[model samples]
Target: MSSRLKRGIRRLCSTLSIPLLGCAPAERWEIPHFEPWVPEEFHPASIVPETKTVIVIGMPVSLPAVETSPSIWYHEEYRTVNTLLDINAYRIAAFLNAKGYPSVALPRDGYGHISVLIERPVAFFSHRHAAFLAGLGTFGVNNVLLTPRFGPRVRFTSVFTAAEIPPDPVLEDPLCIRCMRCARICPVHALPGNDYPDGLTDKRACASRSEELLRHYVSPCGFCIKVCPVGDDRKLYDRETMEIYDERKKEFNRLHRAWRHVRNYGGGERAPGMINKTPPG
Candidate 1:
């Protein structure tokens, strides 16, 4: 790619919060191979060695930040975020399709045909990493993918094809310094312990804890996003401020509970005209 084109692509990827740096050629990480559990049809004849096809797109999922609210307003916000994510994903898919590259949105269900199986040995070759290979973004310490725009706030889906596309070399950042802020913020300790080279995590433990939390109606805990230091102002949170907010949330919940009890058992009567009031004539 020309330097100017490369820079433009980097800027686009960054705007989406995908770290283009980690996808730079000099920093590409080798993916380990494993036997396919089930084989899918591979069309060697369809492979265009020099045609430059296949584009993987990452999809965003709603962060669990506002899930504590009982307000319908928060539910609407959740839907809005989800809609934006879907739109962004399909936009990329459409762009690739228009370019004559067959594209599909890989499902985010965790077990779709091209699912990102983080626990499996083949996870290093996952769709997220494929996007990383495609120069989309870098991996954050939370074991979740981080983009320059979204940080770790997004999930991923991908598309694959047999085009001879020039691969985007992986980018590396010396400034990363392995800060463990993301691990500290993970609600279920999904990240690896501090002392491993490979840094694999206990996926089942993490998933089970997330499921338990979701049962309480917190769909996806975004504690990692609250902790990542990179990204623009809107997505990033100050650690101290987040801590203070957590404290205040606990206090409010306590107060709400006490008020519920009083309203249920206390003999306090509704104020005059409050029980059933009509507009003034």
Candidate 2:
């Protein structure tokens, strides 16, 4: 809140066209500090040399909050985010293909399948670290990815290819602190102990509780996302606080335009909605 810091934030906001209200000092939050994990002299076969390009697209998945049931939000947000991912995946695929890289799309079929399907586990890898490395956003204390645009309110999917694409650089900033707000809010006690030195979390515990919640037919609990100081703000200007907004907006627009184009183009692949249906193989 000092004049110098205020000026620095103002400069950032102005350069990015982000509004200043509801904005907090970057230092106020303990942003995730990720160590780079790239291996030297990586074998090309690990990534399947046939892929010409790889593009990882991050999408938002909603969880139920106290204000709005996580289940309802999850269903709604899942569809919206899934659509956004599909559209963006197509756009990136098209762009890369046009550039002469025979690209293919990857779906959310678990990490193993993702590695095999994309043939570039390193490029298409999943995890909080990979997400951070991709510049989608930083991590919260709960280890959930939080973007300035959506807070911890989003889920992501990636695209992998054989194309020699440049990976997106990680965003550098300390946005998350060791504050246990998110961990404290978890209804399932899935978070790690506050004093754990590694700052690592137990995913199995969290996922198990999430699954249990899903089985009960209640709204999915997004206590982690909800309690995170980052995503709690609902202000428009606050949407610009994170780096993912630009990509999210571009993906949204691309999908909207592409949907219209598909509707008009006619007689190509099945209409958007109909194309994804499973047929008995």
Candidate 3:
């Protein structure tokens, strides 16, 4: 944002005592830090060699777009963010290297050590873990991370480096409302009743259901994310009916029916027939 626009925003915010919308940044400058975000005893040369700090970057999910058709728009948001993250990660690594510190941007999602990952039903590395350590947010019952401003409606990536940066304090207060809405709404009975960080969900069952949903082009099945009555969207959406889609029933149906074409190639790869359809409200 331009200086004038930023000043204008700050002035408007000053009138209302809003905490300045922590959900997304306002294109401001940030200070660098180097605290023990990662415990050295747990670190190994193989996982993140010469890493002194981990920088966790979180991007918020678009609100109404995600709420409109999370299965579809959230997938689109994920793909876009992942691509942007990849590009930025490389740039950050190079910048760190130039400053005489080796830095690596970890892949956000992938099957690392296929056998082990499959056997364990978990990724080798997790952005959620890094985010937790960085004080970015807390975890949800479904193993998804929730930020104070966005709840679980966010995606994160991390960069490990030899550079020492001060670490932010992990959030001490619990963010989960323990409403159990996420569990009751799961169509596949994958998520057992649980809360953030302390309880575990059936990962295998969750993955299986997500895979099944993939055929219908709703791989995300963001029931947990959508249902969480937190963040700004909660005021805009009704947890009872508009959790999965918008209040407009016909538009929601159109979006759901068109997913087979919009997500024809995993995600964000719209097929030719999908061009005529309007985006869900």
Candidate 4:
């Protein structure tokens, strides 16, 4: 390893509190305190010909605004979180490259189409799955990553490089409580009320609801997430704490109506529908 790279790893180990490493000239580029997961086909070699590992990062959605005002802040807040992650992903990739290891950061949620046809809305990769493999979180009933610290309230992106970094262990324990709260609470009945992978079976219904909301520019319904009773942030948005903006449908609509229709972030061009609707008086 170059002296410059060794110095960087030493600092990283110190900051991350990893054990004494490379004391007597160990293999170079083993990142400190980091064992990020490289899924079956995502090994660095597969992704970038010689990438030795993947570095995953997660940013969590805070309480209140994002969770309470799904109609108002849903997409807007999502944009904010993604923008932040995108910048960091790029920065990390650049950092790796500067250290002589070629690396590439994947685009945040808004970009990178797994399906070029637009009709099929899937990401080029599964950020949730990546985070889980990196030991950052696990899947929930809503098929969202339920993190130990953030529940399903996080957004993640990753970078791949040839740094020879070890991989983080996969979480053996499940995170979902099997409460089925997410399904029982979905306004659109999009969830099948089952556990991970199979729970979000009604993709068409979910997409249709989003398309409808796009006409008025209102944030698409994310009621399932808003009502999820997990994480410390949950209390910050749930009914018991927020008298006005909690996820209860009646009050939520009352609030949404007051805002009339919000703006869209993803789906293209408004198609028309709620033409004469007015904000609550």
Runs of candidate 1 with Cα error greater than 4 angstroms are: 1-54, 58-99, 112-125, 162-167, 174-177, 195-197, 234-281
Ranking by TM-score: 4, 3, 2, 1
**1 or 3, which is superior by lDDT?**
3
TM-score of 3: 0.67
Would you estimate the TM-scores of all the predictions?
A: 0.54, 0.55, 0.67, 0.68
Tens-place lDDT per residue, model 2, 1-281, is 13443343245334533321121111111233322232322212244446332334455453222223233334345556656665655655565567555665555334442224224323344434435555667766676677776677666554444454344455677566656767765655767745322465665555555454444333345666655556434453343222321354443232123322332222213333322221100
Q: After superposition, how far is residue 138 of candidate 3 from its true place, in Å?
A: 1.3
Question: Model 1, range 160-197, lDDT digits (tens) per residue?
Answer: 43223446545455223366875665555677745222
Q: Which regions of candidate 2 are displaced past 4 Å?
A: 1-47, 50-54, 61-67, 109-124, 165-167, 193-197, 231-233, 237-281
Q: Write the per-residue lDDT of candidate 4 for residues 127-223, one digit (tens) a residue.
A: 6656665677777778787776657777787776667565556667887777776787665677888876655547666666666665445545565
Reference-based lDDT, residue 107, model 2: 54
Q: Which ten residues in a row have the lowest lDDT in candidate 2?
A: 20-29
Count of residue pairs whose backbone atoms collide, per candidate: 20, 18, 6, 8
Local distance difference test, candidate 4: 0.56
Q: State which candidate has the highest TM-score.
A: 4
Which 10 successive residues of model 4 have the least lDDT summed?
A: 19-28
Better of 1 and 2 by lDDT: 2
| Superposed Cα deviation of residue 124, candidate 2 (Å) | 9.0
